[model samples]
Target: MKKREVLLLAFAEHPEQREKCWISLSECNFSCKGCAALSKKERSRLISSKDLAYLVFKSSRYFWGKIIKIAVITGDEITLNPESLLSLISNLKDYSVKYFELSTNSFMIDEDLLKELIKLKLPILVKMDLKAYDEKIYKEYSGKSEVRVDESLNLFEGIDRRAKLIIKNWKIRYLTINPILTSK
Candidate 1:
């Protein structure tokens, strides 16, 4: 499938550190209730992965006088477009980014995409937001079925096992499940 155009919602340096930056992407696969991305009204024009990388690099240099060492790729559902995400990461690496942290809902990740992500050879910390453990609660909160999350979790486990046996020094930390607990 052709890569979708990336709709950049925001780009800014970390509140406490200039060497870190956040790249927020627009749109999502899931319509989770009370999602922060839902409150973001302004969005940049759709751009290609290469252009987005250049813009990020330029913005970093303009604001901090240097390229950011760490990039946090966060959005409503960053994995919605796997090709675009991979392309963006590849382009960012070209600018010599030291590390990447991807915060996602973990609904769109599949085995193929996971393999591609493993091939990146960069240290990536995946922060997966688990909406809820109960199927009914998950569906109610995210407007999506929980089966996808289970699939993703299984994929992460399988990859982790394979990495341990095949690649002794895997850089990707796999999945860090962060459940979003809410009081009803």
Candidate 2:
């Protein structure tokens, strides 16, 4: 029954069957309209750094051994847990998993963290979404009126600088922009 056992293992490991090991990394008070990850009326969980780290570490070992890709999405803001996440990245690098995927709202990520990521240069994929260009639009989206559009610009600039160094088996791409369309 070796063949049957192998088939059963493969079936168990299917993408749909594999656990979605999410590490809730932010405590958000604002609930934006278009944020798919958030609840329509209320906020989501605020996970601890240690808990997130453990989830990430388990996800790394589980997927890498099977050559499966770990799709890393955030609860609210990734920049909220930069140090813990940097450590997570180090773990992935140690495992030589070589594939990562992240999607973020680009609210918390800053220039220095961007620089640190550049240094790691892991085969990581990042997708950053900008709520809107103007401070008012962003404020409405994130509850932060003082949102620095210039800082976002600087992050993009850093990405531009580090794009070349990231070419070692990295599937690098930038989904550049923010638009506030009012259909009235």
lDDT of 2 by residue, 1-184 (tens): 0000000011113324442233333334446766654333233333333443444455445654443244354555555557766766566455444555555666666777777877887666666656767788778876764355456656665343233222223322222112222112
Inter-residue clash pairs, candidate 2: none
In model 1, pairs of residues that clash are none
Minimum summed lDDT over a 10-residue window in model 1 is located at 173-182
Most accurate candidate by TM-score: 1
Alpha-carbon TM-score of each model against the true structure: 0.76, 0.55
Off by over 4 Å in 2: 1-26, 29-67, 146-149, 158-184
How much is the lDDT of residue 8 in candidate 1? 43
- The positional error of residue 126 in candidate 2, measured at the CA in angstroms, is 2.6
Model 1, span 54-144: residue lDDT tens: 8778877776688878888886678878889999999999998889888888888888988998999988888778999899999999999
Q: After superposition, how far is residue 76 of candidate 2 from its true place, in Å?
A: 1.0
Count of clashes in candidate 2: 0
